[model samples]
Target: MKTGSLRFANIHLQEGPIGLLTSSLRKGRLSQTYIFAGARSVGKTRLAKTFAALLQCLEPVTGPDGSAEDAPSWRPRPTSDVVSVGSAEDAPSWRPRPTSDVVSVGSPDACGKCLSCRRVMAGSHPDVTFLRPQGAEIRVAQVRQMQELALLHPYLGKWRIFIIDPADRLNESSANSLLKILEEAPEKVVFILVAEQVERVLPTIRSRAETVLFQNPSHHAAREAIARVTGRPADEVARVYSLTEGAFGAALNLAAQDLPVTGLLPLREAQVRFLEDLERFSGQVQERVNEAPSLEAALAVVEDPDLLLFPPLLASRKSLVRGLLLAESLPAAFPVLFSRVFLDVLDKARKGLDKVLETVIARQKSAYAAEILKEMDRQFGMAVQNLFQAQVVGLLECLRHWNEDLFHFSHTADETWLLNLDRKDDIMALSLVRGLGFAESGIQLLSRSLELLSRNVQPVLLLEHVLSSIGGRTP
Candidate 1:
């Protein structure tokens, strides 16, 4: 294994799976299909790609031909102990040898410098295909296309590879189509199905493929791996590690940014300010509703908060109405436009934070000489694109944390689990005012909104719906 190779270097904390793969390669016992099951962002896909590259590498390093003595560090089990692929056995139970018996070897790996390896890593090899969800599914059409391609011999490599990412996203039709391929895949063809939830995969498909489990690395291990890659301070890497919820890929991305970790301070402050405003406004609305004599009067009082009295009300009814139209359906209390004001405040805050980020990037750029300014500008451009999304994500994360705290606190009556300890009084008051059901529902709504955001749904609509539902829920 070449340590300098991206294929090897990028993989973290899956020595067992890697050793099994290398052993199979060394013994010429590669399975036609494999199910790499693991949590998202845990390098299953990365290892799959690396394996694909090795399978097609023009200069692979499989040590002395099929000789156990050549590689003294590890040895395969006897034939009697090995469950042959496609045998009448559970996929999960099939193991070539105990992982403890398999050790890492310096051979049976891709020469990442070879042309075939480079092409595979770059995702340009004709024989290597990556099938991902086409707008939320691996459609039947996509699978059929892959089937056609799989029939052909390797265009320029030793084996043809098809990697289906998030294989659980395959709908019934597509999954059945893929099942057909797995049943009788052509010689020299490899199918790697990467799924986060193996249970969601079809039983037939799971039964056909040899399953390789990839476990999530410990946080401390992840922090050290990311630090080694990013060469940043341990504290900074740990902070990014926690912020990304132990997601290795996301942490690496954040660490790779040229902007210092402290550069996010302004963004955090802005999010905190916006959230505070929302909390304060929610309290005021609840107070006004409590004072009203009837539901109608309460709606009227909350919606028509006197701008003179509440100097911080930044959005007008017209703006609120415009924003509400973005949502698929008007919230139950459509007339309660006060909640929409928070959206306006959030927009202003985002724009202000954008400026602050731009200034920071500019200062960083200034440190570079003119010759590299073009490269710096390109890097900053990418950073800017990520910054806008990060800002929205950051706000949503805050809300998510708050909602989670509320839900857990309601269930357990424990303050230790609360992420925002400073907001204990507000959380307690809201819990009392809204009840447990609201907290649960709020978490679901936030979760759905976050998922939609990832799918490129309009952020404006998501924000509008969340604000209206959470802030405008009648007290």
Candidate 2:
């Protein structure tokens, strides 16, 4: 969350990898290629950038012993304070200050004030390049282009750093091309491949690189850090931590958005009340089934609209879902009621999309022609579709957690292990009614739905199938 500086000391809870990289730099054993592997938002990319900056720093801070130290925290200096490292004609005649006057390199950190350091931090460095997925995959052409760039000398720094984020996104041809570069990488060129799921990376590429694994900080550490940064109550930050499952980046993002932690309490209370109503309704349905003269009557009783729909609960659930979506902190174990909420959003967006497109076209028509307008409309539609798909994926994660809780609670009866602690009674009742088999089936269904969703299955159909199957309306 700290801006301006990318020093290793500023990074939270990544001491091991930081030490390794800094030591390697000090000992002149730095690897040409490194795979920084970790879960999403655990500081892998930040560390990569920092390392790159240090490698290319004009006047890297080093200790008396010629090793990097835990450097002092850096703040952005005025443009006048930035020390330029350029050609002799334009560069200032500079010399290193005495060790006592400079920061001690106990292991060397970037001064973060030099022209090279500033450019790298601001993502404007000519020699530093970041390669991300062009669409869903990093294409072979990108790697080929990078290969050409690699053959060139560093533009303005000591090293040419190429960072491929989510390196697992490299498709087969691209990965092969990257492997060739790694095999015979040019001098002073560093390739840092970052991956959340390292297993997805090609075996040859993984084998060629030195891998540094990053782990998430403990919940307590993460909560304290987030609370300190956001200046929010520890208790409030704790709730946000739980919602993000201890991802520091995600917690910071939610805090930046001023997540409605207090409002969540009311949402939970509403959810509990709705579940109680549902439990009671289930009892009534059972009684009706017992009294019914035939299977058709019993089935009709179970499917009644009044029994299935709780209008007040639906309204409360919709508001809560929308708020969470806006905050980008939708809770794990988000209730199954999200199916109805998602359908509602889908319907509204479908109805309004054409009108929204027309408005955009009208505003742009003076500047763009018919073909441009048509292409813009197509892109806008794709963006909306991608947004809807992302929402479905988020909801699927929540349902996955819900089903996991059901499975665990059914086996162990341990509320402490459950993500939805507030929904204990509801989960217990549902577990008993649906049984362990249902929980297992629900988990499988959600997992499959997620996999299918990645293959471009219709989001609406996926939700409908999941809701119906989970509700015992489908086999």
**lDDT, candidates in the order shown:** 0.60, 0.63
Model 2 residue 17 lDDT score: 88
TM-score of each: 0.58, 0.66
Over the stretch 259-332, how does candidate 1's per-residue lDDT look in tens digits? 32222222224334445644454455445445555432433342331311221221122112223322345445
Name the 10 consecutive residues with the lowest summed lDDT in model 2: 75-84
RMSD for all candidates, in order, please.
Answer: 16.0, 14.5
Question: Model 2 Cα displacement at 210 (Å)?
Answer: 1.1
Separately for all candidates shown, the number of backbone clashes (residues 3 or more apart, or on different chains) is 1, 10
> Between which residue pairs do clashes occur in model 2?
62-105, 63-104, 63-105, 67-105, 68-106, 68-107, 68-108, 69-105, 69-106, 69-107
lDDT of 2 by residue, 1-475 (tens): 4343866656777778888776565444556788899886778888899988877777766556553232322211111132222334533222222253333346566777899889999888999999876446788988999999999988898677899988999999999999898877775688999998899999978776788999767555776777776788866665555455345766665665544323333445644544443344334444554565543243344333233232233223433332332232334334345556555655554445445445545654677677756654554455445544554575566667667877988998976666554445666766775567877887899899999999988677787666555533123
